[model samples]
Target: MKKITVFWGCQIPGRLTFLEKSTRLGLAALGYEINDIPEFGCCPEKSLIKNEDEKLWLLTAARNLALAEREGYPLVVACNGCSSTLKTAYVKLKGNPKLLAEVNEKLWEFGLKLGGSLKVYHLIEFLADEVGAGVIKQRVQKPLRGLKIGVHPGCHQNRPSPAASFEDPLNPRKYDILVQALGATTVEYQSKLMCCGNNLTLAGKLDDGWRMARVKIQELTNLRADALTVTCPACFMQFDQKQALYARQGDILNLPVLTYMELLALALGIEAEELNLKEHRVDPSPVLRKAGIINEPLPFNEEVLKRCLTCGACEYDCPSARTGVMSPQGIIKRFLNGEIEELINSSEIWECVECHTCLEYCPQRFGMEKVFTWLKHQAMVRETYPNSLKSGYEMFVKTGRLAKIDDRQRQKLGLPSLSSQEPRQFVEKLL
Candidate 1:
């Protein structure tokens, strides 16, 4: 079996043991031999310590890396912040002899020197690149279908390109690809790439941190996303804890925030209790139901569904309905009247562009867009979709992007090179 030193970092073991538990179980299920190092301290946390003392930060991170070197095992970090700090330190010490010597001089007190040779990997990068999403999908005993997950790839995961150049900083898709591989739809929210605001809390600006988390939770809630998935424990805490804190004030966000590993463990047939999901601030029962992990059906407000059927408010806001043959209200009405077969047989159900305009404009807050989505899923399972729809789906399933950027046109306009397309190979197999 493949082996690597698993760095649980500080937060996971201290406050987020659920994340650590799920990560260990998930990785082991994926056939990795996890070598635990109890000697490792905090990745010393870059934002807090590095800004305060650069020298101390470098020496501390270098010590951790040197230990991994002595163990003769590459490091696999579970926390994005930890990975960011370690990777940045590795690049700096390895690239600069004088800096490495200075750090090594300090480390020699503990009989350790900065080896500057061991490689480090974030857990997400390891799974996306090494374990491969294709193999992961094959191992899924319970696919998280019928659930919409909002992915929050924390800022430190793939930023500071010189240190963490494994993924595109501006448009990272590895998290989204992994979510899709679990058979859940990735919901696109406005604040998908925004900071989780844990830094603000750490900086003693508690309200500001809550405000940042609130904005994202509100957006994801509005989009009707079932859960918010994250790779970092800090981001997970920001969303999970803050959401619960706000709820105590009567402002209920109610979105279940889960670490990617926790979600993966669930899909790998690990029980919810084993993953310590109940310890989460927000209850994940609704999300579990939607994912079919629980044996209960998700409750739908019949009055709201009925109100949506009668009100054509969504149709006016739908771009596809405005340009195409069918309206959003028409699809809902047909489904309500038990014309499911006709709706499935027709191409009107597939005409939705999934722009989510109806969701935004619906006064009842529950729109027919979700109804259309369910219909589309049924159509897909029945293989009754239109040829054009099939061709587009096939193309997207084959290529991560619907269409490639015209490099020639970009060059003529003197634009910078296009972002990385590394997601194509893994995403194709995922779909």
Candidate 2:
């Protein structure tokens, strides 16, 4: 049996204890041996601490990494924010020798030093990449067919491309693929990519954060989605408890929020009662009722991915495909076959400029451009991307603009000063 250490962030152990059950029991049911480790601290809450003191955040995360590495086990995090924070620390410590040395020096006092290869997985990363979706589906005794759910990709899981290297931050479909693995369907909504604003809300912007949550809930209701599924506890709380509070004063068309493991547990034949589904703030009856509904069977969930396997419709106009630098169909085929980690260093993905010539004539409403874009993002995460993109991404994230506007240069050129610190200040808050 494969052994993995489970990192339960602050929430699961203290407040969301049921999620701990779901994650532990669900992973065990899926053929994994869970190694329980008690000597772990908070993921250090990135927005809370990182923005306050980056050195402290990095040191804390590094200590956790050292502990996991010392045990020689793959660390699987149960929280999105925890995964993001640790990955961020990993990238910084791995890339900067000086910074790593400083961290290790402090760690030596505790008899711990950060060294050796570090492998960490957010729940979704472990599910989609490490444990193939096909393997999960094969174990499903009760397929969730006919249940239309909405997915809310939490914020921390996407930003700082290098930190969240498991998938494309822009076009993340691993969650959707994992959902479909259980025979359920996912709907696309306008607020699908919008942040739950949990961090914003927690960072003293209550109304603003709740506003984002309301937008997401409203969109999910409009589409009649059974539930809003999330991998992060903060997101689950933002959507679930906030809606419950909203119910006290107004009409919040009962929308349920389920963590990935809770849903996975159900598909694996674990009864709802066993997982304590009723403990949720918002009732999940809608999700339970919608399961296996006998409506006209919609097309299988991954129709586009499946069709791309053999269809060469988008290849004719694809400049990269014609030259044999990269093939759209081949990219799709490899992705569906779960070769994502292997494809991380592939430079040929940068050849496409997302020209929509393939979309215009394709029947699948998809194109090779879509595939290439996701690959480019993953490439950035692994730091294997071309230097040109690396600098541009860094500048944008740092200053909110690709180029730093020079007030002095503008003055020399007889142009008005075009510089503002607001962009940097704004990004600092998000950082």
Candidate 3:
């Protein structure tokens, strides 16, 4: 089992306990045991405190890291704000030993010294890049197949890019990848990358903050998403509680908001009733009901699909993949998007030669060959296998030949004449 530390920043432990519960439950399901630190104080709320007194912010963040450093496990954070704050401090302290000494000077009185060895990870980063979508998919007991989730990969998670080093800082996909790993579809909107303006609210710009959140909410409302998923507590509050206030005043935005951890926990088979979702001002029942039903279990190892989603190594070695007409990644991507019926119906699945060439190039040693084989099995079960394939099978059964012997080319190459008599005798005996 993998062991890690969770830095549940102030907001979650103090106000949003449900997010904590879901995160712990989900990570535990993924084979992680959290080593908690009672000494952690705060991530220091960078927006309001950092610019005013960066040293104090750095000092507090350094102290927190120092507290967790002794455990020597990678620290995972749930909120994007906390993630950015800690990472920035980590980057700053590591780059400037003088600053580290100054922070350590202040921390010595508290009997704490910042060693700066602890690796920090935002939860989405840990899930996608570390634990991997493959392991998450392997643990999924119920996939959120039918519900369309609107992902709010809040800005702080990747902004100030040098510090975070997350996947695709500008156009992030790790959140979408985490969501899709649970078997739900993610929708695109115009303001997908917009800031939630929580910092504006904290900076005494409540009206401006609400307006920014309102526009994104309205866009998603127009898009008719089943629910919104966020990676930040601030964004969650902006959409959930703030929107709740609007409902009381008769605005009634009617969109349920959830954090990525909560969705992951639910997908990992934790009951919705146990998650304390009642704390949300907006109701999550509609989404829960839509996604609550467990679909028929996957027939193959789901880890294969998860690992296959990111790999195209096989495409380089396969003749069919080189044609560019039927790429393996395309088929797996569509399959991950819950488009299996559409894919199984298309002629694309039949195009493979079952040559096992892809197995040679695949990094995981399992290749698109398994996917093609699975599709073939489904095709046979559904009577969708093409007539040409059926004729080939029948030809093999009756005469031990799929087609007439093409010995002319063989003769031209100075090969020997083809002999079918021995094969026919062998086929008769097998029958």
In order, the Cα lDDT scores of the candidates are 0.83, 0.81, 0.83
Backbone steric clashes in candidate 2, count:
0
- Backbone steric clashes in candidate 1, count: 0
Give the per-residue lDDT of model 2 (tens digit) for 323-345. 77777777777877866645655
Clashing residue pairs in candidate 3 (N, C-alpha, C atoms within 3 angstroms)? none
Error of 2 at 354 (Å): 54
The TM-score leader among the candidates is 1
| Model 3 lDDT tens row, 60-121 | 98888888887889998877888899898899999999888988899899998878678889
The digit string of per-residue lDDT tens for model 1 on 1-431 reads 77899888888899888788899899889998888778998888877899899888888889899989888877898988888889988998889998888888889999998776787888889889988999999999878876888999989899778697588888899889998999888998778889989999998998899999889889988776889999898898899988898899998879999889989999999988898788899999878865657543223565677888777776667887677667777677676776765676687877787887777877877767777787676656435677787887777766667776788798999998775666677784553
lDDT of 1: 0.83
Q: Indicate the TM-score of model 2.
A: 0.67
Residue 338 in model 2: lDDT: 66
lDDT at position 72, candidate 3: 86
Query: For each candidate, how many residue pairs have backbone atoms clashing (under 3 Å)?
Result: 0, 0, 0
Ten-residue region with minimum lDDT total, candidate 1: 294-303
Model 3: which ten-residue window has the lowest total lDDT?
A: 289-298
